[model samples]
Target: MRHIERQIVQLKEKILRVGTLVEEAISKSITALINRDSALAQRVMASDEEIDRMEVEVEEECLKILALYQPVAADLRLVVAALKINNDLERIGDLAKNIAKRVAQLAGEGPIDLPAEIRTMATLAQEMVRQSLDAVVNGDTALARQVREEDDAVDDARQRVRRMVLQGIKVEPERVECLLRVNSVSKHIERIADMATNIAEDVIYMVEGDIVRHRSSDY
Candidate 1:
């Protein structure tokens, strides 16, 4: 392979490294939350700093490639997508950290029972991120689109959990504070879904050269 192609390959590998880290962080955050594992939650939070560092390094590498190689065609798309996906992955890591923060607060609440919907929402959101990264690896626009479409399932799960929490708070006003934390975790998961959608959108853009409309809004 030529020098530029080699760099592109390295770039994809680096991006995938970050993708995998954020994905595991998301999973561990949910596990810590459900299990009330404060030690594991602290692990997730500590890893965020490393994730942040990786994000910066990826951005710098992309800039270096653009300045040095002036990549064209698919190479340009890959570089651009790398930049966008890097940002999205970093945000996903932050969202996972946010979930960890909430989980740490709820650790002492004693045997918290998250609604089924909340668990489903978290599961779906994590899958979205995982599949989005897969799409990037395979350059599969169809898979990327599927990941984007799955965002709604996560959102639906979120709405259901929100209603469940709200209703629970209405009946047991004394537990309102705890229920509110559940609601906050649900919101964090939904936002993570949004970030996954963003990564899928970028993957589609990378593969098809087609710009997905209203890239930010959830429909």
Candidate 2:
């Protein structure tokens, strides 16, 4: 195999490895939130630095490829997509840390119920991130489009939480602060899903050579 070809393969493996770590971080953050496990939340927060470091490493590798290989065509697309996905994954890690931060605050507040919608949104967002990475790894545009479509589901889940929290605060004004925390967590999860959609869009661009970031329904 050619030298640039091998480097491209190695780069692919590196990003995929980073993707797996980001996925685990999201999943563990959700688990920690639902179970109210401070230890797990702390674990997620502690590892976030490592995730950031990995993202930097992947980005440096991508720039190295772009400078050294100056690859064209599909190879160039793959490297660019990896660079974008790396940022998205790092942001997702930050979102998960945000969730973990909320979990930490909740631990001090005694027992409080997590809205069903929040849990549902967590699961959906986690799935979106996982499938987004899957679409990239498999170079599946159909799956990428499917991932895009799923973003609507995540948005719906977030809105549902908003509605529920509105009603909840009206009835129990004393817990308004807690309700708002729940609202913030829902928003964080929504952002994570949005980032996943971004990754999926980048995957489509990588495979199909089509830019779909700001395109509408008819695009």
Candidate 3:
């Protein structure tokens, strides 16, 4: 392979590494929240540094490629996507960490009924993140578009969670603090879904040279 091509390949690998770390963090945070596993939540929080470091590494490599090769066309798009996706993945990692923090707070609270919608929302958000990364790996704009479409389901689920939490707060004022934490977790998961959608849009841009951001689904 040519030198620039090789660097681009490495760049993808590095970005995917960050994705893997962020995915694991998200999964662990959700598990910790549902199980009330403070130890596991701490583990997720601890790994944020690694994810942040990997993101920086990917960004540096992309800048290096851009400076050395001055890549244009598809190569430029790939590097640009890598840069944006790296930031998104890092933000996802931070959101997962925030969820872990909420889990830690709830771990000591009185027993509270967890909402089913929260689980559904978490599942959809995680799937979106996974599929978005897959789209990046395969350069599959179809998969990327599907990821974009799935964001709506997550948003709806998040709203349901918020309503359920609000009702719970009204019914059992004693559990208000815990329910608020649960709502915060749901919001974090929703933000993670948004970041995943951003990554998916970046993938579409990388592959089709189409800037689909801020556009309707018709794009």
Candidate 4:
């Protein structure tokens, strides 16, 4: 590989490293919340700082490649995709942190059974993040599209959670506060899924050079 290509490869690797950290954070955050483990929640919260640092480093590397390489064609697409994916990963990290914060707040409260839908939502979002990163690493647009398709499942799960929460609130008004927090968690998971979809779209653009934003129907 040429010098520029090597730099691009390094940048890609760094992004994937950051991606892995974010994915782990998401999984651990959900586990902490469901298990009501304050220590695990605190650990996830602490890891967010590292995730933010990685995001900054990845962005800097992309900028360095852009300035030094002046790449064209697919190389240019890859660099741009790296920049976008880096942002998406950072946002996902924040979502995980938000979930951890909720977990910390609910730590002392009585354990409320998690709605089944929340688990489904969290799982689908986590899968989307994993598949999207794999798609980028492998330059597989088909896998990217599959990640996009999985976002719908997350959405459906979120809607189900919303309905369940609303019903819980109606039946037990005193639990409104706890139910609201659970709803927020569901929303956070949905946003995580959205960010994963964005990353998958970036991967598709990098591979095919075709923009899929605002045109999910075609995919």
Q: Rate the local accuracy (lDDT) of all candidates.
A: 0.90, 0.90, 0.91, 0.91
- Per-residue CA lDDT of model 3 for 1-219, tens digit only, reads 999988887888888888888999999999998889999999999999999888888888989999999999999999999999999999999999999998878878867678988889889999999999999999999999999899999989888988989888898898888988989989999999999999999999999999999998667
Candidate 1 backbone collisions, by pair: none
For residue 29, model 3's alpha carbon misses the true position, in angstroms, by: 0.4
Worst 10 residues of 2 by lDDT: 210-219
Q: Which stretches of candidate 3 lie over 4 Å from their true place?
A: none
Q: What is the lDDT of residue 68 in candidate 2?
A: 93
Q: Provide the lowest-lDDT 10-residue window in model 1.
A: 210-219
C-alpha RMSD of each candidate structure in angstroms: 1.9, 1.1, 0.8, 0.8
Residue pairs in collision within model 3: none
TM-score of 3: 0.98
For lDDT, candidate 1 versus 4, the one ahead is 4
- Name the TM-score of candidate 1: 0.96
Count clashes in each candidate, considering only residues at least 3 apart in sequence or on different chains: 0, 0, 0, 0
Once fitted onto the true fold, the runs of candidate 2 whose alpha carbons sit more than 4 angstroms away are 217-219
- Per-candidate TM equals 0.96, 0.97, 0.98, 0.98
Residue-level lDDT tens digits of model 1 in 54-140: 999999999999999999988999899999999999999999999999887887676667887877888899898889999998998
Q: Could you tell me how far off, in angstroms, the CA of residue 176 lies in candidate 1 after the best superposition?
A: 1.4
